[model samples]
Target: MLLELKILFARQAEQQLLQTTRDFHSCKQEEGQLVSSYVLKMKGYIDNLERLGHPVTLGLVLGKIINELHAMLKLYEQTLPKNNAPALHVIRAVKVKKLNKHKKSQPQMAAMGQNHGKGKNREVYAPKPKIPPPPKREDPAKDSICHECGETEH
Candidate 1:
């Protein structure tokens, strides 16, 4: 009975470790999430796996972190030492540049209002030019002419 219980406990630990590993592998940093928080989240999964009796190497964790980070951070990855564990503090401290998301072609949606210092009120307004409507088309029946028979109607 003791041996059976031990096996069951070990199997449960192994299952937990597997689930933790899967979670860690599938973990991805969401948009606007800070690098520190992202690293900490990954560390949490690694810690849980370690506690479950499945040991993960520092190098493997480092690789996983680098792989999961934005491609823009690839330049920073090259700077890390090949063999040693990555410095989480330094990685978290480094600010990853976010892509400029604003479209240049988009028109400004709102104009700023101005306040006048004097008691007299003067409203400033920008007038938009009105677009002229397209010219009306002539009747197709009236305009139709067939040159082959020299006839006004087909």
Candidate 2:
């Protein structure tokens, strides 16, 4: 009976160790989560593993952190401009409108035939007007000559 009990306890300990190892390996930093918090969470897992008689090397921890950071950098790069251009140029290149939650409910009201009046007096949904881009100004140096040098460069 004593030998059987010892074997059962050993098997349980092994299973717990395996589960802890799996948890540590599968941990990942979520989007918008702070790096410090992610690191601390990983540290907790590492501590648990250590308590379970599993030794974690510093190199392994560092490698996992570096790999995760690299992945996050790649994701950030995908959202930003690739070229070394001014942010204004990027903003001007894309035209995006903010979506209003209330605007969506308005369409549903229209679909349900909630017209306030008949014919000309009925409420009609008009598409929002597009905003025109700002007027471009010509460079003064391109048309004006320098008083001392007689050149357009200023």
Strongest candidate by lDDT: 2
What TM-score does candidate 1 reach?
0.44
Clashes by residue pair, model 1: none
**Which portions of model 1 show Cα errors greater than 4 Å?**
72-154
For residues 1-154, write the lDDT of model 1, one tens digit per residue.
Answer: 9999999998988888888988998898877788899999999998898888777899999998987775537655676675453354334333221111332322332233333323223222333558999987577766678768767745
| Residues 1-154, model 2: lDDT tens digits | 9999999999998999998889888888998899899989989988888888887999998998889888887787678765553454434333222222223445565688874455433333434658999887588668788889898856
User: If candidate 1 were superposed on the true structure by all CA atoms, what would the RMSD be?
Assistant: 19.7
TM-scores, one per candidate: 0.44, 0.50
Q: After superposition, how far is residue 48 of candidate 1 from its true place, in Å?
A: 1.7
- Candidate 2, run of 10 with poorest lDDT: 93-102
Error of 2 at 94 (Å): 28
* Candidate 2 residue pairs in clash (backbone atoms < 3 Å): none
Off-target runs (Cα >4 Å) in candidate 2 are 81-154
